[model samples]
Target: MCRWLAYLGEPLRPSTIVLDANNSIVAQSLDSSLGAETVNGDGFGFGWYPTDAPAGTEPALFHSTEPAWNDQNLRELTRAILSPLFFTHVRAAAAPPIQQTNCHPFRYENWMFMHNGAIGGWHKVKRDLTLAIDPSLYPNVLGTTDSEVLFHLALTLGLADDPVAAVGRAIRTVESVGHEHDVQFPWQGTIAVSDGQRVWAFRYSSQGRTRSLFHSADVPTLREMYPDAERLRLFGDEAHLVVSEPLSEMPGVWVEVPESTAAILEPGGYRHEPFLAD
Candidate 1:
């Protein structure tokens, strides 16, 4: 269990959302109204593509085991950095220990991954899932989190070629393995994966109920709805964000992600498609 946000749009400081929003990621770290746990203080991490990088280049990363609010370095990095696409996550420590390596927004080449759910009865299913990962990728795992293992499974299943299919396969395997071990609820909660350009976010669970996730409308639309809200004035038209909860309380500002669906965001716009178990 964790809380995460993915931003894609015109360049802006990370703090604009992480620390400056009405109910910022920092605020959610302490009082996440919709999360299973209110305080995700185990650890935190962030990744952003450098402004100087070539169009297709990868991102730079900074991670720490300290709580987001308790780490001065995060604040320092937040103030000095800006990105059109970035991921920030606060950990609640599900199976994964409180360490820098176990933090979300785990990176591999140009790809970055994070999750807000746990593999049910992980201890029982861990071995089977670990063996499913190609030995080549198995060693890349630096932490014991179910989230990171899931990412490796996706990679082994060809995440770079087709993220949707790769993740779907991984989910299939997770459910398959869990059932063999007599574990229920093999999958749960929301997920986000990106290659520093496009983002794929999914909401799903075995029981047809998933975690709380929402995304903001375009900045122009939000501005019209909250004309007097100063916070809405900071972002450009390209600004878009997918969050675990509404960052602002204003009406018509955020739309909930449908259960059993995946949302994709890119510079062009947003798209939603049904997500089904494999």
Candidate 2:
């Protein structure tokens, strides 16, 4: 339903991928070839962990109801800030109202979460799903989007204690509740989450037909392959990215994240594991 991207590794200006990539997240906001909607102009958000911030600090957030391409403030801020990790999403309102709080990259403490799919029959599932969130976290549910609810549910189920397991538990809970309501495939989308130091990206849908998600190859390997590419040469070995769509057409630069899987990004490297509802 939308497009998003995350970056980890070297400290770089957010615009490097959010605005300057060949098919940048800003470009995808207007002309996404793979997203369910071609133009996701309803709203957008940016969350980044400042390079100079103390460890475990929450990311700073910037959101707007304006389209990414039309927001001069976005350009100004992205160009000015340098971050070790960040998230940016351009939204296409599904069943939710067009408001700034409904944007992606929702934050909770040190973690930031974003999604690019809907929970099928959300109106039917919303109440039950929302009631599952931890009472303390319930107040943080400032938005009405299913994506935001999913983040809270995961937190309630233990996202902070163990992200992968908690996400799996949350999805299972969603599926179980959806099935009870006669909705066959309750979960449908990809999710990206991070805690400043590492990121976790997932590709899953009840029907096995999910949106696009890809992560960049190791910087050193990609650098050797495209020695002349300035973008490739500019990054250090620890740089890594996970995006809703390929940022460029460069072969071997990006690898599609496997279906039904979660890919983890860290300064050391990347890892993939099957993502199941149960």
Candidate 3:
């Protein structure tokens, strides 16, 4: 398993969420309270859209095989960059080699993606699944992690056309292929994807017992609840975060995304919709 955080809303330094929160992404990397694995030390990656970059500009990426907590560069870089939307992932390699290419927060065009779980029986289904990716898109598949394959698989199925539907279709296909290989539980993960604007976070597994996933309470709601909390004041009302675990233990600050569902976060607000695998 892995841990990741997706942020959208105000233009702020990446370090604010990646490092400043009580149980920030950096903290989660070393001491994850809700992850299946306590320490996600394989590698880490960060992807962020430039605040001043022109429209359609792809997000910048920084990946390292070094552990998040042990990397001085990661700390220096996160504090220096500011972005309206960004993704940071601390990986726990299941079977893939711990190389920079296998880091999370994979990118394509103007989109960025990261995942926090695994594809069950990946070895049994790897060949078939890899062959299923559209050849035109397959060349872009640079890493060997099942997480990266899942991204391209979604792309082949039409992620650009419709994120939710494409990912659902991809998972459906993975399970179908898994069943053919006699794998009982074929899919298990929470996914976060962005196209330089809105973000879509998903919670699903073929068996209906997905990993832990949560999103911050709406900014206005958090404001009313904690009027004096200086941290809440730093963010604009539209600020939102979809994380593998609550960034902080503050009461009423986080809400668990229901099993088999998706949350779409855009400028004005966000909405939750059922995410079905079938």
Candidate 4:
């Protein structure tokens, strides 16, 4: 499993959540509370949209094969950058070699994606899924992990046109392939994606018990309820985060995403909907 986060709403310091939270992404690298691995040190990556970059400009990215907790460059970079929508992930290699390409938060044009669980029996089902991908997008499959293939499959199905529908179709296809291969519950994970505007997070598994996912309530709601608390000031007005696990122990601050659910986050706020199958 991996530990990841998708942030939207305000463009402040990237490190504000990556390094500032009580149990920050870096902290989770060594002490994740919900991940099966407990320690996610395989590698790490960060993607963020710059405030001044042009519309088609690609988000800035930094990745390393080293454990995130020990990556000096990661520390140097996150603290110095800022963006409205960003994603950070720490990987726990799932039977693959530890390499930069194996890291999460894979990118394609304006899209960035990350996953926290494995595709059951990926080895057995790899052939069918790989052959099912669109050849035009097949070159983008740089890694052997199920995650990269899944991203491209979503891209193939129509992620850019309609993210929710595209992903739903992609997953359904994955399930069909999985069932044919006799790989029960072939899908497992919490997924997060953003195009530098609206961020979408999903919690789903072929089985009912999926990986853990949570999102913070709106900042205004918290500030209104806490009045004079100085802690509220730590997060900017539009600050919001959705993660594989709670970044802190702040009460009334986090809500667990229901199984087979999806959430969209933007400047307006978070909107959640059941992840119904198409």
lDDT of 3 by residue, 33-111 (tens): 8899999999999999988677678999999998898999988988898899999999988889999999989999998
**Candidate 2: C-alpha lDDT:** 0.92
Worst 10 residues of 3 by lDDT: 48-57
Write the residue-wise lDDT of candidate 4 on 135-245 in tens digits.
988998887778988999999899988888888887888888888888888788889987777888988888878888999998889999788878678777787899989
What TM-score does structure 2 among the candidates reach? 0.98
lDDT of 2 by residue, 1-278 (tens): 99999999889988888888889999999999998999999999999998967768999999999999999999999999999899999999988999989998899999999999999889898999999999998999999999999999999988888899899888889999999999998999999998888899999999998999999999889878877888776677899999999999999989999889999998799999989934
Model 4, residue 245: displacement in angstroms? 0.7
Candidate 4 clash total? 0
How many collisions per candidate?
0, 0, 0, 0
Candidate 4: C-alpha lDDT: 0.85
- Relative to the unseen true structure, what is the C-alpha lDDT of residue 148 in candidate 3, on a scale of 0 to 100? 88
Q: What is the TM-score of each candidate against the true structure?
A: 0.96, 0.98, 0.98, 0.96
* Candidate 1 RMSD to the real structure: 1.4
In the range 192-241, model 1's lDDT, one tens digit per residue, is 99887889999888767788999888788777777887877778788889
Shift of residue 102 alpha carbon in model 1, Å: 0.6
Q: What's model 3's overall lDDT?
A: 0.92
Comparing 1 with 4 on lDDT, the higher-scoring candidate is 1
